[model samples]
Target: MPALEITDLTRLYRRKGGEDFEALAGVDLTVPEGEVHGLLGPNGAGKTTLCKIISTVLLPTSGTVRVLGHDVVTDTHAVKLALGVVFGGEKGLYERLTARQNLDFWAGAYGLSRRRRRARVGELLERVGLDGRADERAGSFSRGMKQRLHLARGLVSDPGVLILDEPTVGMDPVAARDFRALVHELRDGGTTILLTTHDMAEAAALSDRVSLIDRGRLELTESPGTIGDLVSAYERVDARGVPDHVRDRIAALDGVVSVREDQGSLVRVETEQPDATLAVLRTLVDSGVRDVARSRPDLEEVYLHLVGRRGMGVDR
Candidate 1:
């Protein structure tokens, strides 16, 4: 069975004196066991709504969701048992509780006995690199340290499916690196992960395949490499000192997607074929424009192309 199976998922919220807002629109997604699936989109794009429904915190307005072959609606207990959810930031932790105490509390909630809770808590602390500071109060820990503890709390039940909602949001470079390594370790141990993030680089680095969602709709789902290749067909050329006539000529070239002038005499050309790119370069060079550079768009650029630019933050 797939680790997560979502079919025709939809959620609607009624607003006073206004039309109901659709948070998710007939979405369908399936994640096989042990796969790391990245969900990417800007704020107010329904990423959190999807996560909340899958975690059973909110009932979907419509649709069926299954975790480990158990329906989220019909088999809530089984779904909860198989799933671990970690939302980013410090809101979830108890300020006065020590790291060990916090994890123990969650482990107990998962129904682990006293002896097993003790062992599981210790193992989790070590796994998240917090064994050395297990006794420290959560409030005293750094942002990175607290995020690690959050991850440990999520694993208290040894869940088969982990939903990490922007898991590395406030982490520093080193801490983020450590957290990603831990994710890889868990995947190696056969844990399925659904990672939601606004960070394009993070999604590209960690996901086996990524699904892009926007305004409650899925744009596409593809491997990072495959997505890169799709965008690779379009290349960019930047040149300085191009006259208007030459710029217009380049714009009329076959496969040229767009040609826009930047500041002053600098011009940017976007092309969808190698021949177009070469033609653009030849036109620039022949026009005596020596300050020219050609490059391919990166993941972030591709994301903007597909999803459009929106201010980054948590989803509504």
Candidate 2:
């Protein structure tokens, strides 16, 4: 069964001196049980708005959303019982409270028994690598540490579904790696996660599949590799000392899309097929090529090719 489902979800915002605007325009998406589904887009793509509506922090203007069979609007209590949320920003935890105290407070709110709360708090502190400093006031913690606490607090309820928005924005490299591993662990244990992120590498590496959102709509939903392949990307081959005839010859080869001359005697070859890279290199070699290199498109390039060139402005 799908852990989370959204159908024709639309949200409209009214402006004080301007016309009403649609943040989400009839968007539809589903995340299966135990899957880490990523929502990716540049700022102003409605990623945050969608997440807020899903977590019940904001109401949608239209459409429906369900979490584990519970309607977010009609069954708000039941949906909240099954949902855990971690939105990347600085304000969730009470600044004056100790890390342990903060977790204790949230656990109490979840209605965990006193004994159960203690155990859960201990487990989460260790899990988030903050046990050593559990007594420190949260206001004294660094950005990354606070982010970790945000994660721990979300899971304090032991909810089945996790909604994480830009969860690793402030994490250091080491912390980021550990967090990714923790996400994998959660997925393996049957926890469903909906992650929103701008980091292309993070989305590419951690997501089972990604929904690429642009202008408040899903432009594509596929695996990272598939998204990268969606753009008509070519294997870029840079070679030096190639004759004009050789350039034409390379362009005429099967899978070779285009060829152009670069500064300082360099020839650029574009090919649709990656497997044909070796063949192109061989041809260049036969033509007495001096140097050659190959580069391929990744998720970042794909995003730029699709969204950036479309002239969509950054977050509104």
Candidate 3:
């Protein structure tokens, strides 16, 4: 059975201007058990809306959602019980409470017994590396520490499925690395994970398969390595002092869709085929565009191609 399933999910809301806007438009997906699936999209792509719907924070206007065979609308409590959620951004932690106290409070709210609560709190605090700082007040901790505390809260339930939305959104590079390692460890221990992230490297590194969504529609779902192989990407070609005429000539070549001039007369071209694209660079050398080099496709390029390039700067 799938860990989570969504069939034709659609949500609409009335804007203040008296217009109805669709937040999630017939969104559909199925994440297999124990696999790490990624939800990726630009701004207003309904990634968060879908998360909210599944998390029971928001209701869907239509369609069916089943998390571990429990409907989000009908068996809300059962749905919550089956999953652990780590939403990106600041959590609703009590600022004045120590990490230990906060965990104890949430564990009690989650109905963990006094004995289990204490033991689980200790286990998670250590898992997130906050055991040493468990006694310190939450407000005094850094943003990364706070995120770790929230992660502990999410796992205190010992859920079967984990939903991570931008799980490492605000941490330093080191902290983000640690958190990702922890995610892998959990998945190895048999927890199915569905992750939403804007970071390309994180998605590429951790996800078994990535579902790229845009404007509430799934663009394509593919393995990260396969996504790398099948997309037309803007490859940064090295050329300095290349005149507009030369740039235009390269753009006109087959498999070269567009050419852009960046700083210091460096030209970047969107290539349909990476191999054919690089071949065009040899032509550039023949035509006098200097120093053509290839760069790996970044998440920005992939996002721009999947999501519309116009006015899509803030979906996070």
Best by lDDT: 1
lDDT of 3: 0.83
- Give residue 141's error in model 3 in angstroms: 1.5
Q: Distance from true position, residue 120, model 3, in Å?
A: 0.1
| Tens digit per residue, CA lDDT, model 2, 1-316 | 6899999999999989998888899999999989899999878889999999988989999999999989999999998889999998877999999999999999998889999999999999999999999999999999999999999999999889999999998899999998999999998999999999977778778889999998789887899788656544557789888888888888888887668786978888867676667789999888888699888755444555666555445646
lDDT agreement with native, every candidate:
0.89, 0.87, 0.83
The candidate with the higher lDDT, 1 or 2, is: 1
What is the number of backbone collisions in each predicted candidate, taken in the order shown? 0, 0, 2
Candidate 3 clash pair list: 43-315, 238-293
Tens-digit lDDT track of model 1 for 1-316: 8999999999999889988999999999999999999998777788889999999999999999999999999999999999999987778998799999999999998999999999999999998899999999999999888999999999999999999998998888988998999999999999999999977678878999999988898889999787656677778999988888999999999999888887977788988787899999999999998999999865555555677655344345
TM-score of each model, in listed order = 0.85, 0.81, 0.90
Q: Which stretches of candidate 3 lie above 4 Å from their native place?
A: 231-234, 238-240, 261-267, 283-294, 307-316
Which runs of model 2 end up more than 4 angstroms from their true locations?
Answer: 228-301
Q: What is the lDDT of candidate 2?
A: 0.87
Ranking by lDDT: 1, 2, 3
Give one digit per residue, the lDDT tens place, for model 3 in 1-316: 8988999999998778877888878888998888899888766788888888998999999998999889999999999888788788877699899999999998897789999999999999999999999999999998888888888888999989888888787787888889889989988988888889887668878999999988778888899887766553445565676777777777777777567777856777777666657677787887776676777556656667656575436533
Candidate 3 lowest-lDDT run of ten:
307-316
lDDT of 1 at 94: 88
